[model samples]
Target: MPIPERFLDELMARTDIVDLVSESVRLTKKGSSYWGCCPFHSEKTPSFHVVPDRQIYKCFGCGKGGGAINFVMELENLSFWDAVSVLAKRAGMTMPESFGGSPDAQKRREKMLELNRRAALAFHRWLYAPEGAHGLDYLRRRGLSPGTLTRFGLGFAPDTWDALIQEMAKQGYDKRDLLDAGLAVSNKDGRIYDRFRNRVIFPIIDVRGGVIGFGGRVMDDSTPKYLNSPDTPVYNKSRNIFALNIAKKSKAGRVILTEGYMDTIALHQAGFDNAVASLGTSLTEEHAQLLSRYFKDAILSYDGDGAGIAAAQRAIPILEKAGLKVRVLRVTGAKDPDEFIKTHGRDAFARLLDKSENQVDYRLAQLQSKFDLTDDAQKVAFLQEAAQLIAARPSAVEREIYGGHAAQMAGITSESMAQEVSRALRHRLRKEKKQQERRDLAPAAQLQPKARSLRYDNIRSARAEEGVLRLLLLDPALLSRMDDLEGQEFSSPLLGRAFDALRGQAQQGLSPNLASLAQIFTGEEMDHLAQVASQPESAANGPRALTDYISIIRGEGLRRSQEQGDDLLLAMQKKYQKSKAYMEEKP
Candidate 1:
C-alpha cells in the first residue's frame, strides 16, 4: 500500500501551509489570497498566489502551481515521499508504517549516499595525511594554500585501481553500492576499479547539503584531465552546484558562478564568499532556478579561453530568461580565477569582481574588441548580435541605457540604436511566441504532458463535484457538513469517493491534507485531481465561501435530478414498491 490517507490527514492538520510557504516568498494579503513575486521565476510584478482555503498555490507567471507539498518537492528537488517526510518532520508527525516503497530502491539510495559520505571523508582525510603528500604538492604547484585545500575539501584519488574500492569494502561497503554511487566501475574482466585515480577530488553536494558525488582534477597531464561522477541515483550534473552549500550562507544574495571547483575555492579564498560552480558542466536552467531561490543576481566568471568565452555567451540568455540580474566577469592576463588570484594577489582578484560588467556592457566590450568600429560592415554585424542580446532585457529603461552604450561604442546616434534594439526585441518575441505555439501544437511525446486529464465529462457535473472537493480541502469546518451527503447519488465516482473519505476522516476528528488526497489517485486520475485542485477561485474567502460552494453543489445536484425526468421518478417508485413487497413476503 501507498502512504495511508489517515497519516497524511494528521500531517496536514499538524503542518500549516501558510507558515511553510511564507519562508521563501514575501507574501502579502490581497483580497482572499496571498500574493507575492514568484520565487520560481523572475517577475517584477507578483503573480504567485497562495489560497489559504485550499492550501494550494499557483504562479500565473511561470505556470507552476500546486499544494505546499509541491513547493517543497520543486524547491528542494525531493521525491514525493521525501518531500512528505520533510513536511511530516517539520510538523512533528511520524511517517506512517504502512507507507510502501521498494526496499531495493531504498537500499540503492542509501548505498549511494553512504558511499558519497565515505568518499568525501576519505578525500578530506587524504588532504592532510602523509599519503596525500603528492596531492598536496600538486595543489601547491597550482598555487593553492593549505587553507584553500582544506576549505574546498580537496583530496587525492591514488593512481592504483581498486584502492578506494578495497578501502570501502573493508569498511563493510558492497561493490554494488560503490558502482551505484559512481565511485567504482567494472571492467570486461569482471574486476572493479576506482573511477578516479591520481587526481585531486572535490565533492559535489546538493542544496540540502548531502554529498551526492565528486569531481576530480588530475595531478599530472592526462587525457580528459578532469573526471566527474556520472549521473547516478543521487546526483544529476545539470541540477547540482559544487559550492552552493557554503555560498548560500553568505550574507550577500549575489553568487559568483565559475566553471570549475578550483575557481570556486580561489574566489572564496579571495573573500568572494558567494562564489560557486557547476560540477564541470555547462550552465543549466535547473541551476538558474535553484540559484534564484537564494539570490537575485549572478556574475558569470568563466575561463578566458575561446571555448570558455563562448560558453559564457551561450549562458547569458539562459540566466536572463530565469529573471536573474546577470553580469559577466571577464578575467584577462590569466586563464581562470585560480591563475588570476595567483598571478596577482587576492586584492587584484577582488578588484576584478568589483568591476564586474553587465551583459550589455560585456557583450559590447567583447564585440568592440573583436570588430573595428571604423569598418562599417563589422560594426553592423556587431550591432545585430548586440541588439538581439540587449533587447531580451525585461526593462525598457535598462534596454535604453544599453542602447546608448551601443551607440557610443559604435560611434552612432542613440536614437538609431534604440530603434534597432526595439525592432530586434520584437523579432525575438515573435520568434519565441511562434516557438511556444509550435511546442503547444506538437505531439504529446515531444513535450512532457501537463498532468493527463480524466475522460471527458459533462462540464456541469464535474464543476459541481470539483468545487465541493476543493472547498472541502480548503476549509476543515465544512468537513463536518459533508457527512450528510455520504452514499448519495454522485455524477463523478472519484470525486464522490474523495468527498466521502474526507467526511469519514472528519467524523474521526481528522483533516484531509493535500498529500493524502494525492495518495487516493493514480496516473491520469492523479493528474486530473492536481489540475482541478490548482484552480484559482475567489470563493476561497472564509466560511461564507465554503457555504456558498456547498450551496452550489447542492443546486447542481438538484438540477441534475430534474434532467433525469420521469424515468428517475419511476425507478425510485419501483424501488419503494419492491421494498414493501419484500416486507409482506417475509411475514
Candidate 2:
C-alpha cells in the first residue's frame, strides 16, 4: 500500500536535506545555499546545490535535483517506497500497521536480508560442527587465526543439497523465498536445493555492512573452483567490493584493490585492513566510480602475472576516468597478494606498498620491456606507442614530464617526443570531431542529449518544449497559461511526460513540485527536472514570461508541421488558440 501523504510530509519536515547530504558529500555554506561535488556525475568543481527554503538539491552538471528523500533514493539506490520506509525508521515513526498484504520490493528486500543473516549464522556454526571438520582443518592449515575467521564470518556449507534449505525452513523461511534470494537453485523438475555445497563461504557485504550475497570456494578439486551468488533482488556483484564495508572505515586514505576474496582476506588478516577485491570479475566502470566516491587513491594489487598485467592495463583508464589517483602494486617472490603475504610476511609487503609505482611509470616500464631501445626501428615503434600514452594525460605538465622520460629512454631529444605527442593529440581531436560531425548529420542524435529522446523532428521544437517544461516547474500556474498546448504537441517524450504530470496535478488541485514528482520520475529525469526548476524566475514577470514561452512552443509546433502544408499548420494553430482542453486529454 502507498504511504499516507501526511506521514511523508512529516518525514520531510523532520528531515533537513542539507544535513542528509552532508553525511556523505562535504557541503559548504555558500550564501543561503549549500554546495558540493555532484554525486550523480564526475566533476572537479562544485555544481551540486542544496537550497534549504525549497528543500531541494540540484546538480547543475548532471542536472539531478530533488528533496532529501529523492537524494537518498538516488545515492542509496532505493525505491521511492523503500526510501520513505528508511526515513520513517530514521525518524522513529512506525509504518502504517494496516499496510500489509503481499510483499512489495522493499518487503522482499527485508526478507532476503533476514534470510542471508540466518544462512550466514547457520554456515558459521556448521564450520565448527563435526560435519565442517574438513573446512576448519583447511583454514587452520592455511594459518587463519580463530579471530580472523570470526571477523570475516567465514563458513562452510555441507556437501548436501538440502543442508541449508532444511536449516532456513526451520527458521520460518519458505523455500521459494530462499530461491528468490539466490540461496537455492531449482532444477528442471522444480526440485529446489542449496546453491553452495561443501565449500567455504565468504559473505559479500555492502558499505552498509549488510550481507548481500556469498562467494564459495570448493573444499576439493572441483570444476569452476569458485561460485558466486547470481544477481538477486538484493545482490548486484558489480556494484560492490568484497571488503569495502570494512575498508571504508579504515583510517588509510587509499584502498588496495585486489582480485579474489582470499587475497583481500589475507591482506586484512595481515593488518592491511583497507584492502578490497571484486567477486569473480575484473574491474568495471561501476566499481571505479563507487571507489571514487570514498577514496582519492587506489593501489591495484592484482597477481604479478601476464594476465594480471593486462587486466591492470585495462583498468587504469577506467579508474583514472573516475578521478582516482591510481598506482600499481608489483608483488615479487609470489603470484598474488595472499601468496606474497604468506611468503614475505607483513613488513616486507608494507615496503612494497611504499615502493608502488604510479600508473604512467608502470605503463612505460611495461612497454619498454616489450622492446630493446638499441634497435633503431624498434626505438621508433616504442616512441610512437609511448607518445600516444603521454598525449592521453590530462595535464600538459604531466605529459611533458612523462614524455621526457620516454624520449630519454628512446635515446632522443624531449622536443622531438613532444612533437610526436602533439601530432597524436591533434589526430585524436580530429577523430573526435569527425565522429561528432557524423552524429550531427543524424538529427535524432543531436536531440538525444537534450530531450533524452529522438522523436523530435526539429531542434527548435524540442528546445521550446524544454523551455515550456522549465517555465511550468518554476510557476505551476504557468500551466494555466499553456491551456492551448496539448501534451502530444511536445516533440520530446520527456517533455510530454512532464506536461502530462503537470496537467494531472493541476486537475486534482495539487501543486506538483520536485518533491511530489520524485516518486514518479527516474533519477535522470529528476536531474533534468531539477536543472529546469533551477532556472532563475520572478513572480512579477512569470505570467508574461510564460506567455512568451508558450508562444514559442506553439510557433515551433506549427513550423514543424508546415512542410505538410501552410494551410494545415495555420488551421491547427487557429484551432489550438481557441482550444481549452489542450492541457489535458479528452475522453
Candidate 3:
C-alpha cells in the first residue's frame, strides 16, 4: 500500500527543509532564502537556494530542486521510499507498515540486497575452505592478518564457475536472481555461470552497512586484474567507494584515497582506518561529494607510475571543486601503498603520510620533471604553465605562496611570477565576464529548463503554463479560478502532466505541494516543479494573474488544434502582447 497523502503532508510540514539541507550544505541567509554552493554539482558561486517558506530547495546552477524528500533522494542516492524513510526517521515519525512505491521494485531491491549478503557470507566461508586455499595464500602472502581479512569480509570465489550459483540456489535464490545481483553471467549458448570464479572477493558495503555489491581480484596476473560488480538495482560504482562504510567513522579526520582495494585494506590493517578507494574507476565528482560529507580533507595515495600521476592530476580539481582540501602522496622506493607499508613498516608509512604535499606543490613538482631548468626556453615554458595553475587557485594567498616557489625553481624573481599569474587571472576574469554578458543578452535562456530533454517547444505557452503552476503552488485555493481550463490545454506535455497532477491534488482537497506530488513525478520533473515554485508569484494578485494565464493557455490550445499556419504568427503576437500587458501591471 502507498503512504497516505495526509501522512506525507504532515511529514513534510514537520520536516524543515533548511535544517535538513544545512546538515550537508553550509547555508547563509540571503533575503528570504538560504544560499550555498550546490551539492549536486560543483559550483563556485552560491546558486543553491533553500526557501524555507515553500519548504523546498532549487539549485540555479544544476537545475536540481525539490522538497526535503527529494533533497534526501538526490543527496543520499536513495529511492523514493528510502528517502521518505530517512525523512520520517529525522522527523520522529513511524513509517507506515507498508511503504509507498511499486511493491515489485521494493521487493527486487530487497532481494538484491539479501542475495548479496548471502553471497558475501558464502564467499567468506569459502575463503577458509579448501577450495579457497589459493586465495587465502595470496592474501596472507601480502601480509594481511586474519583479523584484517575478516574485518573487511574478504572472501574467495572457488575456481569452478557454478560454486556461487549452486550455493545461492540452495538458499532459495535462482539463477535469475544471481544474475540480477551481478553474481552471475550468461553466455551465448544460454548457459549461466558465476562472474567471479578464481578470484578473491571484496564485499562492497554501503555507509549503512548493507552489502550492495562485490569486487574481486585475481590471485595471478590476468587480462583484467580486477572485476567489479556491474551497476545493479542496488549498486553504482561511480557513486560508491571501497571501505567507506568503515572509513566514515574514522577519527583520523581525513580520508586517504588509494587506487585499488588491496591498498585500502593494507592501510586499514596498518591502523589508517580512513583509507578508501574507487571501485575499478577513477575519482568522480559524485565520489568527491560523497567523500566530502564524511571528511573535509583527502590525501591522494595513488601509485607513483605515470598513470597514477595522471589520475591524481585529474582528481585534484574534482576533489577541490567538491570543497575537499586535497594533498598528494608520493610513495618513494615503493610502487604503491601496499608495497610501501610492507617494505618500510607502518611507522615509516605514517611518516610518508605526514609529509604528503599539497596539490599545488605536487603539481609543480610534476611539471618541473617535464622540463629541464638548465634550458632557458624550457624553464620559461614551465613557468608559463605554472602561472596558469597558480592563478586557478581560489585563494590569493595560495597563489602568491605557490608563485614564489615556481619563481625560485625557474631562477626568476617572485614579482615576475606574480605579474604573470595576475595576467592569467585577468584573462580568466575577462573570459568569464564575456560569458556572463552573453547569458545576460539572452535572458530567455535562463527561463528554459536546465535539462535539455524537458525544454519547452512553445515558449509563449510554456511561459503562461509556468505562471499558472507558480500561482497554484503559491496558493492551492487559486485552483478554483482554473475551472474552465484542463491540463491537456497546456502545450508542453511535461507541463500538462504537471498541471493534471497538481489539479488532481487540489481538487481532491489536498495541499498541492512538491512532497505530495513527488510520488507521481520523476526527479527531473520534481526539480522543474520546485523551480516553478521558487519563482516569484504574487499572492494578492494570484487570482487575477491565474485568470489571465488560463486565457492564454486555452487560446493557445485552440490555436494549436486548428493547425492554421497563416494565423500562427498572428496568434503568437496577440499572446505576447497580452503577456506583456500582464507583466507591466505586476508592479
**What are the models' TM-scores?**
0.83, 0.83, 0.85
lDDT of each residue in 1-587, candidate 1, tens digit only: 66766677667767667788877666789886788767677565688777776676777676666676677766666666766777887887876645574334545676788778888888778766787788888788877777877666778887778778888888898788788888999999998889988788888887677889898887667778799999986789988788888998999778899887877887787788999988777888777766766777899998777887888888877776666788888788887887888789788977887799888788778777888878999999888877887897778998999989988888899999999999999998999999999877865433222433443234455566777777666666766444245425456676677677766666677775454654454434444455567675443463454444444555455556566887775654554345344433431
> Lowest summed lDDT over 10 consecutive residues: which window, candidate 1?
447-456
Off by over 4 Å in 1: 22-46, 98-108, 128-130, 367-378, 424-452, 476-497, 522-531, 534-587
Give one digit per residue, the lDDT tens place, for model 2 in 233-344. Answer: 7788777789999998888889999888888888999999999988788888778767877788889898778988998998888787766899999987888777887888
The residue pairs that clash in candidate 2, if any, are 63-527, 64-527
Clashes of each: 1, 2, 0
| Among all candidates shown, the one with the greatest lDDT | 3
Between prediction 1 and prediction 3, the one with superior TM-score is 3
Sort every candidate by TM-score, greatest first: 3, 2, 1
Alpha-carbon deviation at 136 in model 3, angstroms: 2.6
Q: After aligning candidate 1 to the native by TM-score, how far in Å is the CA of 141 from where it should be?
A: 2.3
What would you estimate as the lDDT of candidate 1? Answer: 0.73
**lDDT of every model, 2 decimals:** 0.73, 0.79, 0.87
Candidate 3 achieves a global lDDT of 0.87
Better of 2 and 3 by TM-score: 3
